[model samples]
Target: MKLIFSIRSYDWIDYAAGLILSESDIYHVMILLKDDDGSMCDCKNFCSQAIYEQRKFDLFNVGKKLGVKKLINLGYDADEIDINKLTSQLQLYLMLSGVNEVYCQYSLPILEILKNICNKLNIKLYFYNIEDRKDEYLMVVGKEIRLSNDIINIKNNLSNLTIGRYTIVVNNETKERFYYIYKE
Candidate 1:
């Protein structure tokens, strides 16, 4: 069983199969709205328009013909229905349909929440890196004082040295350390 996540711009819609619906394979098609920020406004104002609505209807009709059991809307801010809550709801839906796998675009917070949900439901969540086409990387910094290896070596070798945005600290016994001002 497969689960599908639909992403339009920054909003995400997660869908799982239901007992009434059974599809062997699930496909996640991202609707790329041509606009700045492409928020819910895009879906409400533009997508709901007659022309776009027809297009969506056609797409859904085709998907139905192709045996798509569920359709999910993903990417919008879930302030009221946040990621954790949404995933919990989706987990129940997937469980009813016997879905085992989920496919989705990259949304770190949502992905993390979904991971937890999947763990609880014993389902596997799969993430597709859509941003890789632009060559982007996401980094998480754990500490403010963690310095690069080069900066550490330099601070260790020199009693007092200053590198770009880094301050080298040298101990009385000749131990070397690096420090940087907290950016806060």
Candidate 2:
């Protein structure tokens, strides 16, 4: 499957890497950034400039290991484009490229935007939020899709994994959910 990742920082690195590594059917993975400098979001990152640079480098290195196929910058500064234009561009890109899934992290506004676009395109969108888990064990809840066998393998292989009860949520709700846990 083809996937698009809207990235902002290294916060989602472990989840992203885990998903990519576990899902062997991935054929093309595109890294989408909001700016040319590789720092994708307009939000303030907590680290120093030097540390930020290193994080970007480390992120790319991890992507290389995960076999990411393309890196694309949308080329929109904070003041350069409006939401309608951004939405249009994203819609056109995903429609043209036939992207099957979209993975996004860090920014809730961006996630909403992508969620709308993906819903329109009938593509599955997964939001990776590291802070949402209950404890040491990662939790996943999905509306449409189920946890794959690969995830089960990860759960079984890890000795340090904390057992936590998680239920797969399916309802008439419009939102979707997916969570991945892996040791770095």
Backbone Cα, N, C clashes tallied per candidate: 10, 0
Window of ten residues with lowest summed lDDT in model 1? 158-167
Best by lDDT: 2
Measure candidate 1: CA RMSD.
18.9
Candidate 1 lDDT, tens digit per residue, 110-166? 567667778888877666544433332211122122344543343233212211111
Model 2 pairs whose backbones collide: none
Assess the local accuracy of residue 63 in candidate 1 as a C-alpha lDDT between 0 and 100.
46
* Span of 10 residues, lowest total lDDT, candidate 2: 158-167
Please provide, for model 2 over 59-126, each residue's C-alpha lDDT reduced to its tens digit, 9 standing for 90 to 100.
46555665666555454554555778777877888899878877666465677888888888899876
User: Candidate 2, after superposition: displacement of residue 132 in Å?
Assistant: 3.5
Return the lDDT, model 1, position 90: 64
RMSD of each: 18.9, 10.8
| lDDT values for all models | 0.42, 0.51
